[model samples]
Target: MKPFLSIITATFNNEKTLEETINSILNQKYTDFEYIIVDGKSTDNTTAIIKKYEPIFKQKNISFKWISEIDTGIYNAWNKGLKIATGNWISFLGSDDVYLDNALDKYVKKIIEEKNADFVYSKVKLINNNKEVIYIVSDTWKWNQFKRYMKIAHVGAFHNRKYFDTYGIFDESYKISGDYELLLRAKSCLKTTFINEFTAEMKDGGVSNKNVFKAFKEVKKAKINTAGISTIVAFFDFYFSLFKYYLSTFVKKLIK
Candidate 1:
């Protein structure tokens, strides 16, 4: 029998934080899940950290599998994991992120309660380099909010296996907004539930946060291709988002 959940991490050169990511999984109160690490053939000590934890996972009777290879992008690595995930639900985490000890346990309970939900997403804490939470992401799921932007937290969000069978895997073409693109494929019909709890701590300086303009560009493309938005409308939204981003950055600098 397969596990109830499959957690995947696509990592590259994360030697400094991969061990903490692994340890977070090891410390999870909920144990009946599989953990997969898809490495982009890191030149650092990431593989050594993975190897060190392999025996511990096996000893604990958890199905832990990993692969180190050259992938085009994060979505490609995630697609590789999706192909072999033997679970009813799947989630992705970054190598620099970590789960709260009760995270999996909370999700399992929510899944049991919401049998009709295809996607379940919870709030995530955004931590600075010093590990202090700056803010929390993801509000309650609203169709209007989703239509405008990616309002749900992608990290640690649970996607039912059947959703993949119906809508297909993450679009490998997307470098940044692949998670949003996948959900946009479902359009307005995606059944979702929001859990009002912080499930994980995501480092503030991820690729998307660092490259705001590029990420917004991909999001606009995703809206046009998958969400049935007109190119003009998408571009307008993109520019508006860009304005907001710059305004916020300016305000932050002034406050500092």
Candidate 2:
């Protein structure tokens, strides 16, 4: 029987957290799923770790395929994974992140019950290197509300394969915020179901987090191209985003 979900993990020299990320998926209560890992020619022990778990994956009947090569960037790796995925629904799991236990089980159940939703989203927990959960991102919003804030993290989103057939894959042009652009496009064409549960635990210090200015520039461009919001609205949104970023930074310092 074909699996209902395809989870793609993109990585490059992520040996430190790769095993934990892989184990999270392998240990899922939901058994029927496909896992694909796209590695960007890492000069690390990531490949060895992946190989070490080959027998375990085989025992579980989990379909696993990994490609190690130099890719253009993260978006390109994600696009590669999407093309090879063979499940009814698709979701991306960064190599440094981990899905909550039984996350896929809950997602599949919701899909069966809803029957008409094309995209599904949920909350997420942010965790640091020590595996200490720092904060929970619990905001859920429809397309209109999403315009105001990007509350849907990529790790917490799952979409039907049909969505890719209609709208196409992630734009490779965006280095830091391609997922954001993809979500906006998906929202414009499909009705999304927001599940009130934590789907995945996201690792801190991702590319977007590390390169703040570049991410901001890409996000602004994405808002202009993917989002149909007017230029004036986009400008205001950009200004508001800058304000929010600074405010959050200040709050974090205060808490520290």
Candidate 3:
């Protein structure tokens, strides 16, 4: 009797926020999903937090799985989780992110209704480091727009098990844009559905935000390799995005 959904979190030294993430999962109104945590041998109290909640998950009869080890990066850790996920659909939630109480319920209902959809996504509330609301971010999946940039928020997005079986898992070479690369591999054939609801709260300052230039570079490469876009096109997209990122950062600093 496998679950319908599998939620995974790939974390490294995220002790400060991992507890809140776990609590959010525990509080999900829909409880049929399995949970998987992949730890990059965290040197902090992350494992301790996971252990503390192990019994609680068991008490609730929820399937809980975890692993801690040396890994190349976040993508590699996620690949590990993908190997063992037993659900029909899978999603990755950041260790510093939390789901809205009714998030899973909404996602499940939408998934059941959209039987042909292979990828499902919704908006995510972006919160700053202080846990203050910044904005909500997401978009309708348009192949043309996604070709230019990653338009949809991957946070809390559901990926059907068939997607992995058909297109394969995340490419470990990409440190930042692996998720984008994975989606790009499907090209125009990927079926997607969007729920006009905020499903999760994403805390700011993740690796992608902190390493903007490198992430953009990886995104360019992903576009070229997975989407078959011209290198020149990818090059311009990278520089344009880099400029925008710096401009936004500068503006934020000025406001502060």
Candidate 4:
């Protein structure tokens, strides 16, 4: 039997992009999935938008849930969604992001064919606010290679629910970089599969990029706090990541 995927999306006052995100999931060619949306009590029309799509979700017989209550943060909302998810696999889709055409179909088929895989991931194309292509971050890491570089895009990865049981949910202590820490822990335990295909399109102006310096500092602090690495070692890693970020941005400009 094919596995059921629970795609969780968390939103807060995302009226500008909520409908498009919902449409992306609703139009998926793959059928064996549940769509869960956890909203942080948006004071905007986000709830209204979700309600409007309720009939479409029912028509498709898609298991759907939407909660609009105040929460701690994005990761907390994610935890709530995960608790209620009944799918064999789970993937988080940001409210400002969308899957590529037939992304679900391809992912589901790949995982079913490769039954030994514990998690699957693919490339991602970043798009600016104008809908222009920014750059494509390809899947370049296998299991061992992953430790050296953080190549897994959270939005592009589908993980088995069992992995969560073994490892754990996103670390709530981190306001940022919790996803990175979770992946590091998950990869340390599970057997991952890379699809070598573009699974999703991410919108520009993500929180990480919006406040690059602050995000970088938080990530470094989170890594040290969670991983318990030596302060000097963490400093090196922090500077190294900063250097790599600059180099990557330069390379991106050169390619453009």
Off by over 4 Å in 1: 1-3, 206-210
Tell me which residue pairs clash in candidate 1.
none
Which candidate do you rate higher for lDDT, 3 or 4? Answer: 3
Give the least accurate 10-residue stretch of model 1, judged by summed lDDT: 204-213
User: Against the hidden reference, what TM-scores do the models get?
Assistant: 0.95, 0.92, 0.96, 0.88
User: Residue 77 error for model 2, in Å?
Assistant: 0.3
Better of 2 and 3 by lDDT: 3
lDDT of 2 by residue, 122-181 (tens): 889898878788878877656787754567666847888887888888899899888778
The per-residue C-alpha lDDT of model 2 at residue 225 equals 77
Off-target runs (Cα >4 Å) in candidate 2 are 1-3, 186-189, 206-210, 254-256
Q: Write the per-residue lDDT of candidate 4 for residues 27-70, one digit (tens) a residue.
A: 88887899999999999999999999999999999988888899
**How are the candidates ranked when ordered by lDDT, highest leading?**
3, 1, 2, 4
Which candidate leads in lDDT? 3
Candidate 3 wrongly placed segments (more than 4 Å): 1-3, 206-210
lDDT of each: 0.89, 0.82, 0.90, 0.81
Q: After superposing candidate 4 on the true structure, give the runs of residues whose Cα lies further than 4 Å from its correct spot.
A: 142-145, 206-210, 221-230, 243-256
